[model samples]
Target chain A: MTAGAGADAGVVVGVDIGGTKVLAGVVDAGGRVTSTARRTTPGRRVVASQVEDALVEAILESAGGRHLAGVGVAAAGFVDSAGERVMFAPHLPWQGEPLRDLLEDRLGCPVLLDNDANCAARAEAHHGAARGAASALMITMGTGIGGAVLLDGHVLRGANGMAGEFGHMQVVPGGRSCECGRSGCWEQYSSGNALVRDARALMADQPSVLTDMSDGHPDRVTGPMVTTAAEAGDLVARAAFASVGDWLGVGTANLVAALDPEVVVIGGVSAAGDRLLDPARTSLQRTLVGVGHRAVPRLVAAELGPEAGMVGAALLVGGDGTRTAAP
Target chain B: MTAGAGADAGVVVGVDIGGTKVLAGVVDAGGRVTSTARRTTPGRRVVASQVEDALVEAILESAGGRHLAGVGVAAAGFVDSAGERVMFAPHLPWQGEPLRDLLEDRLGCPVLLDNDANCAARAEAHHGAARGAASALMITMGTGIGGAVLLDGHVLRGANGMAGEFGHMQVVPGGRSCECGRSGCWEQYSSGNALVRDARALMADQPSVLTDMSDGHPDRVTGPMVTTAAEAGDLVARAAFASVGDWLGVGTANLVAALDPEVVVIGGVSAAGDRLLDPARTSLQRTLVGVGHRAVPRLVAAELGPEAGMVGAALLVGGDGTRTAAP
Candidate 1:
């Protein structure tokens, strides 16, 4: 195999099963998506089989009769250290489901499974940002934050394949309740949900474009609405990004203190780009320990954008059972 | 060279330079100290050479004219990734000092230097509680919190050699101020200083044995005094452990959430052992994300106790400059 993603090997399909959508892409050897299909995600409230059906539909739609090298599936959940079962998913109706085998049997091909953030990191490490770094941290800020750690270009899957769960780390004690049944998680203050929440909280006190955009209902304010208004130079929307970005920096500073990566690549809800990163970078520099004495890691937006998860998953088409096990 | 510590190799000296003391020990290959010496730490208020002088005096006293394999010095500071200079230290008056060269010059032998927490982790991974674990997180709760991360039996020093600096992670925003100039550092709530601070705060509420033990001077209460009184079942002192231990578990939970190591070995002011671990463990279980769904890393006490740092430093005696260098 040649260097750089082994792209000439064959075409592979990657599927990212997120909270609200099932996204599938047919990725060429050069880490480019040739075709794509999307399906509404039957979320955590639905049966596991229904979600699997949606995944199957999207995968087949994306395939478009192309021969497949294999399929890599990225899920928003606690993938077992073996990368075989989805022990639990905060957004998906999965509980110890052997997702790989089930998908393989249905599709008649080798199937690989990993965390969504790991897939995004793989995409970035191979073709996007965080390239050629000895160590990197990938944080995807969509919905809730998802994290992955790469050391020497390989994902450092901890004892349970659950390392890099940065979002749930407590940034504020008893500050905000999370769906994970914890309070004050980093994601609670820094993700898309957090962006929307802050916008709504700000709407309660002042006049804002968001109130009109969301039809005067705070609950209807979405992440996209806030980003759009922020781009249009709305003060309230800008305030939300500032608050969320500052918190993003605060949480990242905590991680930087512990992991000291070469760079941190942010993906998922990163459409705001500099609007999100500038504040985050400022706070990262302000809060990191030994700030002036050591190299401050650079914080940058992810190069792969929304397609990163699927592109990274597609890269896993090759074989390595080092962290893969099936029962 | 042999199965274990290579005890047949030769005798080496290990020195741990802390904010309060310079502890030196002559350690054999079996990780046992044959002789020990201690001197007061000159601290951040003094010049770097004065601190270095104290270290030299203690190392000579411990050596007692025995032949030496080499010397390994562990500093409670940010040792650069090359293990050459101490970039900065909180308690010691070191600011990017060429510590290894300084020690090697005076002693006329090879000198290895590393962060004290990294040294402690090496000792535990080799001969103590975390032995045989593929991935381990070591948190030393002494005057402040120190952390180290090991992957595949080697320390994962980050891009700046500052990985595993877990103590500065912010658990409470705008909380307590730390010497590092950051507010709400994890150590501010869960270390020896935290123990003393909490004990003193409790003393202000009611008449406790600590009040009499400190001679009614709340500021005079020390970590050992609190530990001693807690072991003796003093209610107020026990309350302090409950607070510190719970915070310990809280900060550890954050680290575990991020690193997800196979084991977490806590040392340093771990003298309280169960009094510290039991409460920490309970809180860890309650706070860890996906707690029941994944393998919760076992939190254990450091077996080598205070000597782990010196022993680990000694382990660096015969090594390639894998992460070591001197100018």
Candidate 2:
């Protein structure tokens, strides 16, 4: 924690507002957290005001005797260039909600907002995983796929302030129906949801050990359960993981062909260590276009773990807000 | 000419060395041509040393009495980072050729080399169709498809300096074989060759206006003939343009979904004054992934015409080897 005092004592508060949980931390200039707090996200029907109030409360609790420099909130949705409003968030009840303005008013400080994946990318670029790289692409595979791009030591926000929507890129024409009302999106094949769906489908077809592995409770077939079963040499779970890995490789290959970044850092629940990446690496080489001609961007697991968004949020306050700063 | 003289007064020569022709011009600092020279390309069987000598002669002849600043050559294939070598050009017999050193020695001036497409994109960004834009994707649809990406006013050269090889991006798996040993690339559907192939294929099977349009010479079908027939309202030729336009839209949509540039400039023989671009514009929206959600990047024909690459080459010299020196 002593290292935190050397960088900049802006006393930044990092908040990761995810679908499953709301994690907040008070970070010093050197990226050390002095106080932390977490809470389950409000229910599906919760209003924007309620979520805003909860976010403000969490910030105050985490602040604990520290003066605030600025606040960074990582929300799961499309954030516009201004970083004050949420354009869209399917999992959250924030449609065109001025989350940044609301938070700033409540906390008495400047606020910056960005997509969760972009937040994770910034964190990796600032402190872990993709640190010191000129360019990198961060992919977070959980219930769904999420992505962020860092170009020339900064994030690439496209013309409309919307880039790195890589999860929505078509991986298959008619593979699976995504909640976005599109089929064959990268997320549907290479995500935690994809793993669970494959596991359930496999269990239904052949009476595999995974069905018995889950003890006949088909509904209990989770991503981690499938991973554990695969590690234990279960055929169905292994197949499911392999399927996810294959799709991961396909998506990564498309990404490499398009962006040509120096490195790709994989995170999220599906990446849980190396099970997903091993197959992904094998498939990446196989599916990669112009294999031997171009330099293959390195694929590595994210080193910052799940708390990367929070750390990145804290780092944003200390780093250049040139583009990712509060408007 | 006065505008050219008003800028920096120092002239720089631009040489375009293609497989079929070698074109050189002395370009003033303001993009005005002072003098010009042209010659047919030398035999491909000879070593690059002979070819370099021929190009140097053309450049010196074009230079005439102009006090030169430098020379920028737009080679037909992949050019290295230093803009001094032709790394690989399948159509042209050049492999790891030190083009700049050879030319600088012969021409007695500093030399810059870059792929024709990159130079074309740079040209459009500086003084052509994409002028004043923050970013753009330039697609040159000639006998082959060539591409370049301009980001923040600089051509985006990837890790291996081979980033803008968009024509080689696989559009269809195992589809029409290419000379690059690939199948179903974007260029296969949208290039000049694609136009002729589709026109010939239509002439053979479907009984349509193409037979009468071609004046019974079915074997002599060409891109220009199709353009003329399309203007005359030939259904088959219109269909051919539509087909190419469809693929152009698909390829451009893929790019739009990835880069999200402010504009997409269509150049080369296919653009032949918006005959191709009219349908391309309509199809681009239809094929766009998030059609209704995002602002579509403007699709336009190159204003600098076929000389875009040559003009861009001159601008490189005018800028004195610093690519981003111009507006």
Candidate 3:
């Protein structure tokens, strides 16, 4: 393919280290992935170095000996506002780890690090669903909910670089107990885990195609299983989406009340598209206040596929991290 | 007293229009009020012109023949992003009313208009509790909750200027009903009304000092009466504060999770001081995530009293509006 913005900037590799896997990609300036590699994350149980080993393995394979510009790493963790260290990560063993500096020293090149949600938002802001919006909220629902705030063309990293931890925002008092030790978190009601929980609960009360799909074992049901069943017109799966989607709208309304963003983009499990967003829109309209006097921002699903994290990580490098360094 | 910052600039008057009162003040640049006047607010039932009449009376009274530099209006309503019109208010007559232009046409001087919560936040940011903080959240609780966000040096006004509407955020699903046509808003559990609700609920279970204080009528109880009772060491009153304060901390923990501000300033009912905030601080520490890992933003009461709205409004007209234009 002819070179675009990413290629013009030189060949750069981006890596997205998530809960279950590490995905690395060779990206061009145009936000397209030319080649990719993946590995099952060694995870937190292993030494922190082992996880880095898997990351390096994926990155080197994706580069394929191309002259490298720089590399960007987007990890599902609390990256400091200066993008210097990973303060903490629930799924990865990174606590106060200076991943960026360490990676730069090991690779002998530039390295950029940031929160995965922020990177995803930056990608949307630059090329995907949220382009041109002055203020936007990016909500990505995977095993849990992740969020990033964009204001005046920049991600609003808070005092501790933890500004967009939206999943923990309490939506229900004394409702569901969250792993965060807080009850009634928004994620407890609207995430991949919540979707599966709803599906399993639905099976207990009524008949479902999922019973056979999961071999009559509720524990066997996964998020992808429900999504596929719902796509094929299963009532139990569709109901679960409606339930989770409604909860998503409630939380979005709460956020809209606070931030009044110009747009909201739903990523992660967003391949479900209208099935998840249509009900959310209805609930958002019902829950939001001052509807007649104020503008209700558009809610849209992410345009990018699973590669959003990797592409967005690449965008963070921005023609190589040698210039426009992270602040 | 000699003038501080206010005298160095020209003479300015600020008006705060609330649900029940219209307070006007002649404020100097040093954030001090030299003279003041008050009038009962005509509220939303009256024609828009009548409310303006009350404002003009207070403005004239406070100015007391001093040459006016400018006038600022802090209304309990939604101010447009351009600061030109009052888009809507729960307790006032403004609905897309161009108060700024109308006042300028009549008085022939510059007029700046903004939301009362934003005005209060500006006061704290300029010279009160949040001074010198890199970022802060100002939450003022009276009949309900009012909030504003300060980032860097400027108040972070979002799209349509409706940012920081924190009171209406849903904290309970299918819980208390709010006047905003929503259920379980944060204000329902943590505002003046919530305190009274807790006090009245407590009164139902036992005989207490509130019975004599309110003349044996629960409806006769007022916020001030409860505060006085609590100050005098009434267990029931103290419990009510604890209840409301705990809810305040719960809601605050939610906000901190999302924004991670450097400071949180509590205004309005803050005259109770440690009586209210001590419980909130304890609960905030208990409920916040990553307790040992993240910095717990200081939770403090606002220093300015009832005059914060007026003082902040005056500051909006800094050194004359002809210089640093509002953008």
Candidate 4:
């Protein structure tokens, strides 16, 4: 089936469930979000029912009496190959949860669940920076690095649908410890969290505008604050960005060596446009194997922003023709 | 067309061109080598015509007057996407030479050219360790690391045929100098060359059987000698194998994080069974991302051994229905 199908008679509901927020939208076949709704995600300590309640509310508000063809949930977790269950979600209350069936039952429509990064990659391949490319690598650098690979216009969801976890590839031996019980993961040096961590360390040692922005509490410095400070010409903030971008390039080089995609699209909060991509481009060229002899894949910023995940989810449900069976 | 076709009527010749040796074989549709021939690769300083002559001689000897359907050349170099010219071969005297057309003219049959690693990976997917796997990553650890990826049985050749140069991926920040003009490439720590390098370094500092095996010259220690010594319970030799295997595992972990294949097939000389893979297995588990939560791809040794490249090349020509057009 063609991608982003159902452009004429039907609309799909796309819900993006993150750790702190849930964003839902009614997307038509053309990838247009006609209606949107947002809700604060309940804390992880809350019951699974509470989280489900938040998702249901967001979908209901977004649907707003529209005839829905299918519903897609872009979740921040490990989605199973069948798109029926969430095996684990670090920040959400999901462990072997049948999220797809529950949503289908509640909404009375077909539902498909997928990792947010995969959804975003599909979105980019269908309508954004990676459009028309034979293959692409999409990296969403938020709190940590999340990745998705599109090969021949299909998401390469490994054997267990857990492929493209590029962040955890160890770059340094016995270096920075990670929550996944590993050290020197690419994310430790290149993600949004890495940017803030480096910025805070720089703040501790040097005088910078970040100290004032964080109100003298370096611990309170978030990723966005550092980006803001860097844009204002803060040396420490810019240095942190440079460090992260360098590591991003190193990791991209490793990916290119392995996958050899036609283009690499950087998304999520760290897409900081030229701030992150310029240094990444330089480092990627410097570190890439056979740089002088080989054709270097284009490195570009993602065209779609945060809304990419929701739109991609909607498209996947509408296009792949995999709808929930009737209750 | 199905892979390894033409089992009933015509046979194909597969030729593997390496730095030191050229191996050619007559392969039937069942992936069996009926007749084989070998020759010394002319030194790189020799003219390109001499190298081509050596390959043609091997093919003629292997064909033995049998009706040939096609001939496939698996060269150790950067082959372009069209499989007609060799962009650059490190150890061969070829630069943008139209090897395919030249071979077809001499052989009076169809000809196809491809990277040696891609040929080997294709062989495994069709007839060996990676058979039946939905996706597989093949790592050939000879003097250096060569890699190939197969998805749904087709080799992922990337935009250019230069996608599988896994040896050049920098694993260390500034560790060992590589022939590719890079530092700390995976090959520096993990290939057959790495094993010999480590053995020599150990022989320099410590008393070991390798010194005696090399006739008191540490520089003369070869990869096979070290492997044989390690099999004989030599500590230094075992340590070298362990070191190479650990790096192999680390590189495998990086590949898994990006590709997430169902199985990883280790081929080439270093597929010395458990000597390399046992240590690789331990390190792969230790370095793999989401170790406990995600399914660990089974790691297995290649089934076809050194003959895989030749066999795969024959299969590529016999299958895919792409042959040199009759002039």
Candidate 5:
């Protein structure tokens, strides 16, 4: 493959450290991935160092002897404002760990750290659906909802680097209990987990294609399974999507009321294209405050898909392929 | 009275055009009010020119023959990003009017316009409770829950200069209907109207001191009357404060999750010291997401009280009293 601009100088590594897996890729200045590597994440039960080791292995495999300039780690957790530590990651084993320093020390290169959702938002703003939008709110509907706010083409990292934790915003008072130890969080009713939970609950009450897909076991139902069934025209699966999409719309309306973004980009694996978005648009229009008077934000699906996090993380490090100042 | 440093150069007239009244003051560089004036706001039923006339009267009366450099109008409405038009004000007569140019021409001076809540937030950030806060979420609990987000000592006006419309955020899924045509907005449950609504509903069921305060008419019950009765240890009135405070806390928690501000300042007329704040604090602590893990923002009462909007508006004009570009 022909090298892109700045590829001859040095390539930067971008790592998306999620709960289930670690995906790393060597990205050039133009956001092109030159090489990639992936591995299963060591579960939270293991020592934190084990997870760090996995990240190192993925980076090394992806680099493939390329001159490394810096590394950007997009983690699914609260990265401190200094971009030096992972304050906490519920699904990962990190609590006030100096991950940035550790990685920089081991990799022999400068390392930048950020929340995964923020990385995805940066990627979308720079190269995907939210490009050219003055302000955008990106919601990633994975195992739970993860959100990032972009204004003037930059991520709005609040007092702490913990801004854009939209999933935890209470949409339903005293509704479902969230793993974050909250009740009625937007994610509890609108995320991948929510879809699975709704589908499983419905399967228990009424027969659905999801039950057969999960081998007639309600407990075995998954988010993607429901999406697959919905794609095949399953009535119960479609209803589950409708329920989650409604909650998503409710939360989006709240964000719109507060942020007034020009657009909202729905990302993550469970977005399921039009199946989730169609209902979300209907509900958002119905529930938006000042519906007739105010400008409604355009809601669209994310273009970069799963690779957005890594691509964004790589871009966050300066154009020269070195660590940049915190956003 | 001795004139402040820049007072002799030229003073800026700051006008706070609220729903009930027009409060105008001549302010110096050090944020001191040299002279002040107030006029009853012509209700929304009147033509837009009548309201503009009231603002003019207030400014001219407050000028006190001082060498005026410019004027800043802080209105209880959505000012456009260009600081020109008032999009919509629930309690005012303005509707897509070119208020800034009209006022500038009429007064023969450069004029800046902004939302009252944004002005209050700026004042708080510069000279009040949120003075040293890195980021602050200021909630003004008056006729409704007007809010502004301050970052790095500057107001974060979103894409359309309508970022701080926090009152319209849906706190209740299918609760009370709001005038904005949305159901269960935060303001609908936690505003001055909500406080009075709760107190009046309680008055119908039980005897209270408010009956004597409001001449035994539930319709006549005001926010201050409820505060007075609650201070007098009336159970129903105190319960009303508790209910409103709880919703306030719930919304604050949601804001905390989304913005993670360093501080949250409760302002406006209905936030009567500890009466409303005590229960709000309790609810904020109880409902805050990631309660044990995350850093909880300091919640406090506004220091400047009602005059904040006027002072902040005057400051927005410029350091030298000329109208600066829109914030």
Candidate 6:
């Protein structure tokens, strides 16, 4: 085979299944995405079959008659060390299912699977936030928190490929119980859920300006709503964001203390702008040990946005797994 | 150079200096220690000259008349990334001193410097607890705490080479003020100091048996004393250890969540058999975020003990940095 052909021979179809939608694309050599398609994620009822059908259709559309290679899927939850099974996913229907083999069989190609956060970090390391970084960590603060680590330009997949669960790190004991069955996990304090929780809690106690905006419906307070109200000079909404920012800083500080990453890339819906980041940056520095004396990692927002998982999934599918997995 | 010699050519002298003693040895290929010697660490009264002379003698003795290579000295505190200097060491006399050059001139050999905890981790990764492991963290819970990370068998020396300062991570906000001027650092709640703090606090508040044993002299109730009291079934001492264990588990859980290490090695004086480790292991498992479902990294006591630094330093001095540094 020609050098270029051999290099591109492993083109894998990448699929990113998020809570709200499924995005699929063909990723080839040099980390390029070909044809792409998107569809809403099916409801819990008949979700498995619906997701599979949507993924298959997306894969077919993305191939567009081109020579297909393998398939790579990035979703939430713990993936096996082999990157061929979904042991458990909080957001998806899959639990201890051999997803890779099933997808490979349907697509007529080999398949690999990984945590979505890991895929995002891989994508960033290869082409985005961590393009030329020596060591970096990407943390997505959304509905739930997701995280990825890239060391020496390579993703650090732990023994079980369950690495980069940065959101679940315990920030405080007996604080708040998470859906993951753990209390005071970093995500419960820094994620979209945490933001909404904070805003709702504040609105419940104090008669705030957001009350008029929400028409006295406390349940209507969402992450974006809090951000908007904060920007519009709402005291309770701003305090909620600041509290989440403090937790975010605490989480980042803990990560830095452990890994000493050269850079930390913040992503997900929470990274809408400087509204959440300013407080996060200040708190990260304030909480960091030896803040002034050491070369603390630079905290920057992710540039690739929602597409990071898609690109990263493509790379994971197209490239050899050796580069992504730690030695 | 012959193949065998090429792999082992950089035989740098390595020394592990601690509060109570100093250890020096000749490290060869494959992390073997050839000549070894130890001496009581001189006090601050006759600091610089005494320490320098001791170091020079150790290096010459360890060499055993072989053509000497460079030196790798591992000490405490925020070690300057440069192979030639120490920025600040709280326990030691020097500050921003050209230690490498001074040692080089004294012995006419190039020298490399690192934090002693990092040296211990290198030793463990190369030959002890974390051997054959791809990703792990080594924590020395001594009079204070020290930390190091091994990802894919490589040490993560952050942008400034001071990456693994884990003991400084905040476990509790406004809990306890550390010597580093930070309040509620992990070390304050989980190290030897933590044990002492817990014991002292317990003795003062509760009518513990230790009050009778030490007769209200908190200084007399050392870590070993607490261990002895616990072994004899002293409830308060056991409770104190349990508290430390919980914090230990918390700190380690934080580390695992942040770094996703495949193994965690607990070293230091406090890890004297099962007194500390039993609770540590239980607490670690309980506090771990995805404990039962994921490939949980092993939490085991270190086998190398105080000798780890010397052994690891020998390994560092003997081999090219590529294997451990670049993996």
The best candidate by TM-score is: 4
Off by over 4 Å in 3: A1-10, A26-28, A64-67, A318-320, A323-327, B1-9, B64-67, B318-320, B323-327
| Fnat of model 1, as a fraction | 0.85
Residue range A1-327, candidate 4, lDDT tens digits: 222335444567888999989999987667788889999999688889899999999988897876566788899999987788999998898898999899888877778888999989988888888998888899988889998889766789888888889999888988899988989899999999999999999989999999998899999999889888999999999999999998999889988987778999998743377888889999999988878777899988888898999988886674544563210
Candidate 1 lDDT for residue A56: 87
Question: Which of candidates 4 and 6 reaches a greater lDDT?
Answer: 4
lDDT of 4 at A144: 90
lDDT, candidate 4, equals 0.86
Candidate 2, residue B187: how far the Cα is off, in Å: 2.6
What lDDT does the true structure give each of the candidates? 0.84, 0.74, 0.85, 0.86, 0.85, 0.74
When summed lDDT is taken over every stretch of 10 residues in candidate 3 chain B, the lowest stretch is B1-10
Worst 10 residues of 2 chain A by lDDT: A1-10
Highest DockQ: which candidate? 1
Query: Which pairs clash in model 6?
Result: B12-B70, B123-B312
TM-score of candidate 2 versus the correct structure, residues matched by position: 0.90
Residue A125, candidate 6: how far off, in angstroms? 1.6
Could you give the CAPRI-style class of model 4?
medium
Residue B294's lDDT within candidate 4 is: 81
Residue B287 C-alpha lDDT in model 5: 82
Model 1: runs farther than 4 Å from truth?
A1-10, A35-67, A106-108, A319-327, B1-10, B34-68, B91-93, B105-109, B319-327
Highest lDDT scorer: 4
Docking level for model 5: medium
lDDT of 6 at B297: 79
RMSD of 2: 3.5
For all candidates, the clash counts are 2, 0, 10, 0, 0, 2
Once superposed on the true structure, which residue ranges of model 4 sit more than 4 Å away at CA?
A1-9, A269-271, A319-327, B1-9, B269-271, B319-327
Give one digit per residue, the lDDT tens place, for model 3 in B1-327.
111234435578889999999999988768889999999999789999999999998998998876677888899989998899998888888889999999988777788888888888888888899988888999998899989888864677778899888899988888899999888999998999988888988998877799999888998889988899899888888999998899899889888888889999999866678888999999899878767878999999999988989988887786753423441
Model 3: how large is the Cα RMSD against the reference? 3.1
**lDDT tens per residue, model 1, A107-197:** 8777889988888888888888988899999988878888888886677788999888899999988889998899999999999999999
Model 4 TM-score, all chains together: 0.95
